[model samples]
Target: MAQAKTTLRTTAAAKAASKAPTNATADKLVGTLRDTMVSLVRRDGPDLSARQLAVFLTCYLQEEGHTVRGLAAELNVSKPAITRALDRLGELDLARRKVDPLDRRSVLVQRTLKGAAYLREIRSIMGETSTVAKKETETRVVRATRRAA
Candidate 1:
């Protein structure tokens, strides 16, 4: 007696593979996101580079009483990375480091008056830009969607 032919097919497997993101596409997306964040920060304050602004924001947040460890975790960066950023801000005289009086082992970062002024200016610019961007995006999305007759 002859046995029926056995066959294996992978059409679904091929389609699934096709749907996956390519490394190049992922890299391009990362680059675009970096550029956009930089643009937004620049729109907020043309004076600070993206890196500088990132450091400044971290210091400002800490000055508002956030801990360095907390900021590092929230930012998804290592403690050293956060510390380096803070160092840059300190070097610029925008932030200062102080030893926690309650815990001698802990060092706290605080924003200086200059830092506060810079942050205020950035907030004003960012607020205006954010308003415009929100309106523009809303209009575009509405225009793109179909409306009932």
Candidate 2:
């Protein structure tokens, strides 16, 4: 009975130890996203709305073949909403709409150089923010361990 209890405790400890890194990673990701957004607003000043940001990210992060209809379906928004977002993106020159050669009715979303540059900047900001967050977390852990000891 004692052996069984020890084994169960060990298993629980292992699971908890495994989950600690995953939780830390998720926290860092959230922090990085927040920091990147603040940096983008402060530096670029496009002041993108939530829907606009969502649309922009979907276009840049996902594979090609993005169309108005496809984006609407993917985002669970109306076609007009997608169109409006596209219009805003167009105004910023971040994205352009091109009529599909195969289907004239379908409008394809294309990335621009400006948009690519913006994405690259965001990636850099995210990486830097994540690294900072990780260091802070490690420092906090070290402090806590010292306190415990």
Candidate 3:
């Protein structure tokens, strides 16, 4: 009975693996991210650090009303680290701080036009990179199948 249960579990796992999405999609996403980072550094030349990139993406991707304490907690980092990232972002004109009128002690992280434009450009780069990566992957697969047969 135990042997039968183990066989059944193994078969189920195999079926789940077969039904999983192709690795090509994941590869394309990774390629797109890498290309986007390179483009940001080469073309735009802001040369942001990893933390800065994380903070930037989170702010743009998420809704407004982001606070230092909230961001620090969400990112699992220290408040000073968040503050440093915010400082760098402010210097690059990607983000700014605003005193929350409701809470004088809290500061709000506000988005800038430059930051929005940067995000749009990154989106375009990622789209283009994904398209190219998908085409390459398809071509490679076709060649491999042809050689196999």
Candidate 4:
């Protein structure tokens, strides 16, 4: 019962946050996020959970090499959680894990060719979002100007 109440409180907080007014930049960023998500879902690509995508992007974007321990620490998640996400990524052929040559005990997370292509796709989708946001902003400006004239 306590757990259920905590869950309800969390849900209420989320709803309140959504209703909170944000600055134009924050609103625009959220718009971009929404559009990007819609594009990804419309495509036939593998649907990833938020956690999986976070792990994927962190591994790909970071200059430093990634290990299960490193990833967990970087993401503030548990090792098992990282492993689970990696398992899904491996299943999708988007990423792979290899035994580190320097330390056999440690495993390294490496990027796959498919993962690179997927990152490219994400970039393209974000670019499209930027263009759409620009158009929307311009339209708003035009409407405001017409009202003033």
> Best-fitting candidate, measured by TM-score?
3
Clashing pairs in 2: none
- Report the Cα RMSD per candidate: 8.0, 2.4, 3.0, 9.9
Q: Over the stretch 20-103, how does candidate 4's per-residue lDDT look in tens digits? A: 746667888889988998899999999999999999999999878999999999899999999999999999998999999999
**lDDT values for all models:** 0.66, 0.91, 0.89, 0.94
* lDDT value, candidate 1, whole model: 0.66
Question: Model 4: residues >4 Å from true position, as ranges?
Answer: 1-22
Of the candidates numbered 1 and 4, which has the greater lDDT value?
4
Which portions of model 2 show Cα errors greater than 4 Å? 1-22
Q: CA shift at 44, candidate 1, in angstroms?
A: 12
C-alpha lDDT of residue 50 in model 1: 57
lDDT of 3 at 3: 100
For all predicted structures, in order, the TM-scores are 0.51, 0.82, 0.84, 0.83
* lDDT, model 3: 0.89
lDDT of 4 at 25: 73
lDDT of 3 at 145: 100
Residue 135 shift from truth in candidate 1, angstroms: 6.6
Off by over 4 Å in 1: 1-52, 58-64, 131-149
- lDDT per residue for candidate 3 within 33-110, as digits (tens), equals 898788778884578899998999999999867999999999999999999999999999999999999999998999
Provide the clashing-pair count of each candidate structure: 0, 0, 0, 0
